[model samples]
Target: MINTIVIDTEDMDVKPSAVILSIGGFAFDVTNTSETQTAILQVARDPELALYSAQAFYGLVDTFEQLMMGRSVSSETQQWWRAQGEEAHEALVGERQNLATQLLHLSGWISQHREARIFFRGTDFDGSILEHAYRMCGVECPWRYNGKRDVRTYIDAMTRGIRGYVKDHQPCFAMTKHCALHDAMNDAEQMTLAHQINSEMLAA
Candidate 1:
């Protein structure tokens, strides 16, 4: 009896009362006025935090490369790389330290809301990304299959579930589209898809 119905961000409707959930560059704008009254949940990563982690990892790799190449480390490059590494280290450590607190907050948020649906991009690795972010934020997601490797299967299951829900509930018209994972979609394209899905969902 899963009451939540999660939709991809690109499929969101732009209704006035829609709950918007934005994570990374993706967003879910859900119309909450349906008879079911599902809450739209958006899970977004903090760009600054992700950037810090990436910079740190990249710096360490580049430093090791420079060392292997026998190139003298310029003072400027050394300083810049060291700073990036430190920033990343700090960000990661902070996230780990706060993991518990973040999870509690997420659990609370989900429990408080009636119909809670999570939206993100990429059916392959997005779940892992969300899990890592949640860990950093001190939250433990009760939802199973919230990892990157499980996404493909999870999506397949979701599609089947949606299909069944539509058939049983007799929605006007239900539509599902598969997009490239992790690729960026232009604003126009995203908006168009969102509108199209809304129209179809309403028709169902």
Candidate 2:
């Protein structure tokens, strides 16, 4: 709801690694709780990614061969995904295409929402991967770093500011729906809801 561009990235490597597997996001207008079209990237799948299954698939290893272009894998992270449930597992696999082509599509989306504040759960991972992709294609990053925001801080603060409480209930998408595109969509929807809650709190 806050004129946000919610984003998420699936990476081959863990921290300090830009080997992103996919990027997905969408724009949201907090004013009307309106959402824009979603943007998703499909990179070239790598066979080597299959080796990390002993630890865990995380979305990258399980979906690597099915996904698009990406960097090397992170064994530690792979184990984490392997430990997740089927719902989370299902979220990793998605449509596939070349990294360049997918980025081109993502680039256009970013451009359209250039003025909006870009939000990512882990800006270090998601934001860095996005910049790396644009750099790889020799395209300028559509949004300035200053305009980019972190979802964790904003959501936590807003929740407390409004004295909001999270209910003990099932999630809209099970843990299996933790894929890159779906996660991005989820973040956007949460922000939209947060904006609405904030508005109501202020009005009262």
Clashes of each: 17, 12
Deviation from native of the Cα of residue 117 in model 1, angstroms: 2.4
Candidate 2 lDDT, tens digit per residue, 80-191? 7677778555555555555556666665666665567778886777787667667765767777867668776666565554332222323343322556656665565566
- TM-scores for every candidate against the unseen true structure: 0.29, 0.68
**Against the correct fold, how does model 2 do in TM-score?**
0.68
Q: Tell me how far the alpha carbon of residue 70 in candidate 1 is from the true structure, in angstroms, after superposition.
A: 29
Model 1 C-alpha lDDT per residue in residues 74-118, reported as the tens digit of each score: 455345435553433332222221223433534444454344344
In model 2, state the lDDT of residue 58: 21
- Judging by lDDT against the true structure, name the best candidate: 2
Provide C-alpha RMSD values for all models, in order: 15.6, 8.9
Model 1 Cα shift for residue 9 (angstroms): 14
Estimate every model's Cα lDDT from 0 to 1. 0.29, 0.55
